[model samples]
Target: MTERPVTQFGPDFPFAHDDWIRHPSGLGAIPTDSHGASVAVIGAGLSGLVAAYELMKLGLRPILFESGQLGGRLRSQPFEGADDVVAELGGMRFPVSGTGFYHYADLLGLETKPFPNPLTEAAGSTVIDLEGETFYAKSLGDLPSVFQEVAKAYDEALESGANYSALKQAIRTRDKARIKEIWNPIVQAWDERTFYDFVTSSPAFQRLSFRHREVFGQVGFGTGGWDSDFPNSMLEILRVNVTECDDRQRFFVGGVERLPQGLWRRAPDRMVHWPKGTSLQSLNGGALRPGASAIRRLPDGKVAVRDRWGREDVFDAVIATCQSWLLTTAIDTEESLFSQKLWMALDRTRYMQSSKTFVMVDRPFWKDVDPRTGRDAMSMTLTDRLTRGTYLFDNGPDRPGVICLTYSWMSDALKMLPLPVERRVELALSALEKIYPGLDIAGHVLGDPITVSWEDDPNFLGAFKGALPGHYRYNHRMYGHFMQENLPPSERGIFLAGDDISWTPAWAEGAVQTALNAVWGVMTHLGGRSHADNPGPGDAYPEWGPVALPD
Candidate 1:
């Protein structure tokens, strides 16, 4: 037998979604009879929308049910009376490593610009404030000596704790065997450890003082302040860094929401049941149905979904893309529909709290050089203060700009939950005033500020899953749901797809990849098959599947 090619993602199992979709083998076709079969897709977010669109191409009729807005957490709130100026309440940045999600963005013809992450070229300059000491610099080299030490310590810790360089090279070369060898051991070692434990226990971090760890927590490498993630599993942090999820970030030009909306309206070259020019919009009569309230299995084995108004629809299969918490709260999911093991996985899933506040400025005033130091007056700020991290967006020198006054998580986010938009803005401004001393941030504000506390939102419950120590078994169960061929028929039809179900949560690529997994599951359930040359995940599972977790 010919030797099979090694999997792309190896033990980390990110799901080589971009590779699979664009492969010459193609996703394959369904039987002509299966073309018009209805499939219920809950939540019109990136995952649901992508799955529905791909299924439509494969001859399946996907009926999307969304309880909230179509974009779900990819929400872009426009400034009052100013359509162009907006705030991204969720999922603002996209990383280049998320090739799978970008495939859809490319197909949609959406433009992207580099996100202004701290110390990146797009940020121009960055300010680091800790314990009443403030430092401003154009790049990492310009920061204080202690900051450089923190960066070096972090690098050394990764190299020591996890053979960082070898893993990076393995990932870069797509050396699946080497990647599995390096990553599997790390997963075993770190799966039960918190990020704080990894940091404090590392030899490199131990050489430094407690202050070093505190600074590292306040202003983390790549992104800002990782104190929010200190309680999460070290395995989760390692996956993010090794995959380069925090690097080379970009943002959708208009809004991330455009990706899903564009897909909804896009007319593909060919579709299974619809005419040549048909789009999801046309199929649904320009609107998605109301949210799904209940899901159960029918007597004949079909999945029955009920809308908010008690309207019932039965389909051959169902793909739930909503947050897992909804299974108990908003939706009356049948207990028998899922195995107790699967139910435990869904119930144990933990979501992190996040909050963001944005204010529209008259223009990119931060571009102006300060007369005293010849530096941009207001650099993208990362501080231990109440604001945590502040980002500035430049539409142009003359056009309106947006400032994310506070992008915080966990306790920081919870503090702002009780406050209204105006009060939140006031706290952020007060914090910034202490940092700048003389800048008039309030004067340039164009309209009312926009804010979001993801925890307050009923549909989401929280921002995204932050796997706790000892949660690997739960994650393993959730991520493996798409591979249901071995599952009993009673547990087969209802599929799960979302960032929350992927190995790497909070990234859009996770959502896209899981959607593809569900697509494969639905196609197979409906008597469809991927082409022999281009086998789907089901065909490749035995050889290239997710890493097996120890019970």
Candidate 2:
């Protein structure tokens, strides 16, 4: 193992997994007699599961309420009759930089392989289609000179406008002070600007033709086309890049859903209220309570939650891990549960539309050498056509392979919102048919295709929050909710936890980090104190909290 550096956050501020289990969580233990104290946890996603697991270890009973499946956005759907073949409907790639999330993945013994990102080795080969032209490449060097120029311009802009290198170094070293110093300035400058504004405004891009910008929008670096994110806050894009959220990406071997499912049945080495063999699955008697329909604060300083089936339960505290909008739409929540300022933040949270259509093939035919060109039969594709990004997942030589025919966002996704799964698949194939003229893509398809339009799903109105320009104040209010020391007692117990509440919105690491924050908040609320040696998030919040919004 590499020597873990002791940073200002004590080797754990960013990840926190090591500190959580290495020593006694500095939380004051719950009273032995009060081990039966029950806490209501809204949503059974990664955030809620983690918070419940930790709280259970600390002797508090947690009753989970989930409107959807347990994994939340980590939806992994296996193809019919091919259990080994799965399509990741949401959150396919995960960066290794998300060490907090990796801690759980490692603990669960889940296997992962490098994701086939564009221009990466795992992709084998890449095909770029734009303006009635197609370019095939083994690497970026293989692309045309114009594409190379665009990539270079993007790098130059980041260095000149965002101090990319310095910021990366600060984050890599976990130097909170240095990170804040570098990040706060960029946030102030870019928070109110759109990503397109930053790119087009750059002198590097201006030196080239408008076509360069067009190609950059269709085949951006790290991931794929970023044109869909053009209207989002520049800060959102910068956060993803500087934090390495787009680098060294990997996907779970069987399914990304394993992380949350594993935690549901995992038995910690030590626990307070339950026995050594106790698991969340066993504690809940094998099923989660139905989705929460209503939540109200009782006069006795407790929380009352009613499920869709009208099953009501009262608890000393509540941890709502669902999307913010659900608090208003799906669940009838009391107005007093949150301050008006908080409600504004929650109501204004903007979720991006996303759609993905996938199909399973008999084999990884893309690996076959083409008799004519001596290249792979097919390559991971990026096109300005209707299909923006296409991914190929090779299960194995014998098992069926999965192909994400079309993965689009925003306007691109909304265009297919009303279409059926079959029609969506047809449209994607029609676009791809134009790119790979003679490739028998249809003949290779083995089973029915699966499709998802996140915006159409009531549980999650959209894929993830894409903060618009000038929305940092709202985000600041939401992210700072766990720090309720100054808030009234009525607002103290019902805490919020989810990726949307984090600075880096779409990543699982954000969910894990924010869940830890709620864990600390709940512990403190229950009169538990952090152990003197291993301080919780609240104990160390002032010294290493999120970068504050600049004036």
Candidate 3:
């Protein structure tokens, strides 16, 4: 028998969202009366666009509201005077395990290439600098024995602490019962514990020195340093590993922004109640409406969404796809729209800080090899310094190259948040110069640098959600709210979707999955039902939903 490949089947929900979206029978059918119903989708990000697109396919009209850039955090800022050359300031890497997200990417027929992650073949060479020491390697085998020991200890920790192999096997085979059997207990045990707690308490790490722990954080098992996430929930880290969200990563060719923008302009080959040439762009009259400033439920049971300009429109349903905090901060959402418990969940949901600095260069000079040393001019770098992780993008020999000088999180991100873009580049260059002495990186730079601090923007206070210890119930409340059967009539029409509303918060797959959930929620709310052969998340939610804990 062929072994089933692993995708983002939830340890929490365990629904095959990838399978659900790709079903030949279609998502669902709306009632004839609700065919042209107006559904307000707030925010023009991945989640909002996806919900809008799917709802349009189901024969409903989706009105999108945008306050900032259309792509939201999937921004790909192009350098001046450069053709198709871009800096992926946010959400650059996509792992193969994220089948739910790739379903849409594939639908758009976007081209992708393997990302240049450290220690991977795509990077060609990786440079590891820690505690003022430098080491270069082509693979993990070339690193020192300490790295091997750290890697092995992490593996053992997973096996001894989390039943790594069996649990992953369950996920790969799509065994919902077995997955919940193994996962629910771990959630109970680790929900209140931090990632650092899991590492220090584990027998494997206890056998090793604290230096091993530091090395493990500075140069993590996959990608790069994960010390920033050490303060997050152990459940969060475990989700990233078990689901392979950090493995076999790839990036969209032109830019990741293409996915959402393409979906916006794309006209589905088959759609109901609309003309052959209809599209979200055409439906909205070639542009998105202004940002939503307020949401209020009408006496007639319909919802009124008011734009920043004070123009109000009534809709049968509204899907809030913006950052959960925006509900309290940016949007004047009615208190009666959600229960106090859910509002607590939404209000308390924590978001992490992230910053990226990128510069376009004259060419991919880093790929050039020096005659004296058998090494390339520069390699993909990981360090414990302020720069954190530096990535290189080679468009082609004849085209301009792009370099992400620093991709930092939390404190590291905060350090760069106040600095100007020029200073950010100078500091990154200063850090790298020490690692590669005499390397003139400044000489190869060209055009102006582009940087982003997600928290600095009013639209998005942070890059993505980072659930803390003891937040599982909060996550459950927000994620399961789409199945609104028992909710009072007052709150039934308003729904939520986004990465923040998902179990795996930092991943685009989470955004895609939750968006599909809102589609299911909106359809069912309007007296529609999924095809019997192709049940939606809400259909299987009752039997395979996330486990709930005591209040």
Candidate 4:
């Protein structure tokens, strides 16, 4: 057996064991006294997988169900001609802000590479076209001539309530003139002639609203809000929190998926292995059975799930790590307060429609010119381009630079895009050349760009989940509100475990933190009074979380 790498955040790491004791819920003892039955984790995404793995450490057994491949969105593809030029489609490039995830990776022996931040693969000679004129704003001194005007406008725009239009539409309108007076100020902010002005209000801010002039208006920048925007000062704070004080911009030497792979590796044998590529036909009401424990309840009774081959099994309990859309379409129809409330909560929230484009080529196709020291090599692009995403890394010296392009596209185009595997690849490749000009496409286009537009998948329905301006602060959870309360007082059999439930949604870090919470709950429940008021564990390397969500 390979010697386990000296873990930076292992159990023996300083204050490791103490962290488990400090959680509000206790470090769980196995549930030998309570029920002594097995627990099942639904979905093999990062959270579900980690929770099951952690439970087994306390001597409780867990089963994981994955309708698709494990790793949720840690997607990878093998390039034919390039030497080890693998491409990642989704969930690539975790920042220094991934605090707990960093700890998890260190323990798993995964090596993280401090890759610089650039908006795309084309490093040098990159241009931002606006008003038919282009500018290259790579360095600090390269600020565009109109940067100051943009700065003031951007400040007003940000300070404005974020969704001023939506908030304006929902305000109390008892008085007509009063309503108009209230709205006039907000209208001036949102309709500064166009959303374009609102975004480009700042020179450094154009990309925040996806106003890059390279492509037509149909395309845009990374679709997420500025709350988690790259290059923001927020990342500096996040890096301090997620990583040790020494860490900075990094991409896992192998790939971003290695972070999850690392966390998965730290898990015991019981968790490292699971049933993969198995389809879940239906889940019966595990929670509603006669005298059944609370954890096992399904919506109506308990979910009775059938496999793709139509084999059926209704377990005593289930751990659902599903995204919002999955519950609406794939779940079996029984009925229960939990399921009804859960679906309703999801129904109330709005999710962004996304289209992801991953372009993997044969070699270091783009010319890299470093401006810091007048060198001709830099593996990052932070441009404000339409139809572009963050991250361009040296996939390997063999392939040079295998670029992964991600864009948050409109979800309504689920029909505008192709459904079949072959068609999907063709569409992605065509989209790639359209964004990057003068790149020899004759044979340079290796295979095809892999597109993962989650809006259509019956299993996930959409990407993990999204949070609007005030959504993060207003409500702890946009979709999973009911489950938050369903956890028993001091003892919860059913715990909400997933990346979507935490602050850093849609990443392995959030998922792992949720797992740590579940393990804490389980240990507390099994130990009875022995483990009371204990501060639970963290994502293995140990980032922090609120014991309870804000009301």
Candidate 5:
């Protein structure tokens, strides 16, 4: 048999959500009496939307509540005059390993192309600038020997510190037992460690100079610099690497926001009890309710959610897909709904900062090669400067192109948090000028610059969850909340689903997987059961759930 490709099945919970959703048996069935039962879905983000969409197909009425726009982080903002040219302000690059997310994309028939990440053929060329030195390369081999050394050392460290090859092979083949056997112990061993700790302490890295480590951080192997995530958990980084979350990435042709929008408007052909023409959009009256301001468990055992306009609605089940921190800061959530330990996990979830500044150019001017150097005017850039990572998007010669002047995270992101879009573009151009001297980057610009500082957005709080050292217990609490049979009755109906609630936070696949978990939870709560042939995440979860660590 051919080996299955690596997917985000689980370093934590090895459930095949993609297959479950694709099953012809169709994600279980609810009783006729429970059909059309109301469920509240907070935040119309990817997770919330996925939960709502699946729930709708399961014959549940999902009332979507959103304080922000339809697509939460999959925001694709269009330039004023450019036809269909968009600046993806959030969740731009998606990896092919994200089969769960792509399942929906395929359902919607959205087109995708390789994202122009540094050193990939999609990028055409890559420029790395670090500590006042700049080097151009089309591939890793073309860079300095030090870069090759750094890449080799990191690979060696992965093999040395973790059973990298065997573990990845198990994940690829979907060997549930072997996956748990290898990954569970690693979780226990490294749950207390940070990514920085892993890198600094690894014998392979220790053998190299600190400069090598710095280079590795500045120009990370797959995407770009990961120094921003240096303080994050080693487990988090390992999950990304093993799952190939940062490799072989692609972006939606029009924009990723089309995904959630497509889901909202799509009428699934295989819906359970709903009419053939019904969709989440049609069910919710073509618009979502206002953002939920407060949530309380009523005396009658059902949950009541009050919208921003003081409209209180009751639901048999509620799924909260907002950032976990919003439970404390924005929403007035009842204290008794979750155990104090679970509340602690929600409150302690740390989110990373991120900023992106984009400008629409008249054409793909960056593709123009200079006769003197025989190099494109500029290339996908990774630098130590505030710009951090700059990506170029070419939209055929006739159409306008987009330039993400800078995509920075952590401290680098925070620097641009206070700046206006124009100022942000100016700062990015200044940084780029240092790399592409005498190039007319400013002259190619058309339309107003677009930018976003996710951390500054109250709705998001931060870009995505970045687990810190010793946060495994917290992650376990959030990720496994959907499997709540053993929990007290008061906490049973409220399910949590988001990338943050998933082991691999920041990846869309996490959101998709967790959403499926919530769908299973809600289905079961509503007196539904999966078909014997095709078990849902909840059915498979007991034996294949995340390994519990002693608190």
Candidate 6:
């Protein structure tokens, strides 16, 4: 079957740059530095790569260092050909919301596509009842009402009988506008606050609204799984920023990794220190993986590195452009003064237990794969009552008989199960076959399973830290937290970057911000003029939403 490109919607929404993107463009102010400057970027994931790419634009020859392949969360495991269009084992699917990510992808030149039909047409099924060892095939669009129905029953219990309103302010309006004014605000809040807390706390839940229970009805609504103690408020933040789209709507074009892939191909020469399997011991005073003396920080600051027992080189300035947790841990005491404070911020953080399950199917689940990627991992929630899988995606292959596998995210109770790799694979395959009944998913031959446990990966304990209730206003202040304090350009040389420092929390978007922050930090530090002045200081993702109520 021939593939057709789906139309994209509002900017930062989906199918980015498809004339539908509505978010504002421009990086808000990341100026280029003087000519021929040296820079070192640590961590080769989206954040590190973006930082390096941005540095190149700034006239600084930037070098990127990593212990693994590029794309950190955005990377995949081919287990085969270099360009066999590797299957994504990491980040997948972009939410219509999450403006920062959308904004960053567009800037880097990635395209978006529309969603699929029957919805289940993409994948024969979407639900796997692992708890009961059952399979549930259904469209997620039906979710909103599903939860509403369940909430209706829960509402009755919360109403306190006659003259009793579960809503805190004693108000109720189903109107979208009314909902936006009243309910939407509530939704936004609950979304960011943490579902567990909101479930346990929100007066609204006690008062119950149609939206409250409906959230769980939606696939990811109870995303962390209704069983989770974590709050939905944080997820709500990502939701609030997302653009709402119609059902049978998704996208993918010329391959989903186009943007990041392009950035790499376009500036391959600029990327340095891209070593595979050469893990670091620690970082300090502008140096990476101290010990063995395989690292060289040249007089100009261009980091020259070798494998575990390789060679050496130099670099001018080092842009710690990965996750703050990794960078902070690697940094030795003295040189890393803010370690304690940064560690505090990290400590205050929380994250959902999520895992990615990449499956190579025999054909396009839908007529086409969505161009955007994020939140495709399989998940389970309450009201919406999903069976645990949260998302799915394409393998980026164009062959006719190819089974472009999808990466599903499992959070909540499902993530807690400490099963072995073989057992996990069997469980995932069983789940896939059950939910996607009638599909030749299991029959599809070839390829051993390749998975990365971000939820368990030692370097990163979670798939990026989550901001807890009331953790904001200062959360991004720490991780991905950008401080515009000015210093001479030279003094700004040691720049701290990474998605954690950029407020986007472990996503590519945050990485871009960190790059801008680090370089901008350097500019201000140098006393030299930069492209755009600090609009002030602090994290950038929007903050106005209210706590979320479990749907």
Best by lDDT: 3
Q: Write the per-residue lDDT of candidate 2 for residues 1-551, one digit (tens) a residue.
A: 67433221221134354456456553457667668688899999899998888888888888999888999999899999997588999899999877778878998899999999999999999999998799999999999999899999999989988988877777666766777777777877888999999999998998889889988888998899888889999988888887788888999998999999999999988788688888888888789999999999889999999999998989988999999999999999999989999999999999999999999999999999999988888899999888899999998899899999999999999999999999998899999989988998989998789999999888999999999999888888887788888999778799999999887888998888788888888887777777787777777777766556654
Q: For model 3, how does the per-residue alpha-carbon lDDT over 79-143 read when each residue is reduced to its tens digit? A: 99997899997899999999989989999999999999999988989999999999999999999
Give each model a TM-score: 0.97, 0.96, 0.99, 0.64, 0.99, 0.62
lDDT of each residue in 1-551, candidate 5, tens digit only = 78688998897888888899998888889898999999999999999999999999989999999999999999999999766799999999999999999999999999999999999999999999998899999999999999999999999989988899999999898999999999999999999899989999999899999999899889888999879989999999999999999899999888999999999999988887899989999999989999999999998889999999999999999999999999999999999999999999999999999999999998999899988899988999999999999999998999989999999999999999888888999999998998999998999899899999999998998999999999999999888888888998888899999999999998999999999999999999988989899999888888998888998
Ranked by TM-score, the better of candidates 1 and 6 is 1
Alpha-carbon lDDT, every model: 0.88, 0.86, 0.93, 0.45, 0.93, 0.43
Candidate 1 displacement at residue 459 in angstroms: 0.4
Candidates sorted by lDDT, descending order? Answer: 3, 5, 1, 2, 4, 6
* Clash pairs (backbone) in predicted model 5: none
Residue 373 lDDT (model 5): 93
User: Could you tell me the lDDT of residue 38 within candidate 6?
Assistant: 53
For candidate 3, the per-residue lDDT at 50 reads 94
Clashing residue pairs in all predictions, respectively, total 0, 7, 0, 45, 0, 100
lDDT of 1 by residue, 263-375 (tens): 89998875666789888777777899899999998888998999999999899999999999999899999998888988999999999999999999999999888899888
lDDT of 5 at 463: 95
Instruction: Name the runs in model 4 displaced over 4 angstroms.
Output: 1-26, 31-36, 81-84, 119-126, 147-249, 259-316, 337-340, 368-386, 411-416, 419-437, 441-443, 468-492, 525-534, 537-551
lDDT of 1: 0.88
The TM-score obtained by model 4 is 0.64
Superposed Cα deviation of residue 291, candidate 6 (Å): 12
| TM-score: model 1 vs. ground truth | 0.97
Model 6 Cα lDDT, one tens digit per residue, 420-529:
55555666555555544444555654455555556676445566655556555335345333343433222334566655554445345445545555654544443434
Per-residue error for 15 in candidate 4, Å, reads 16
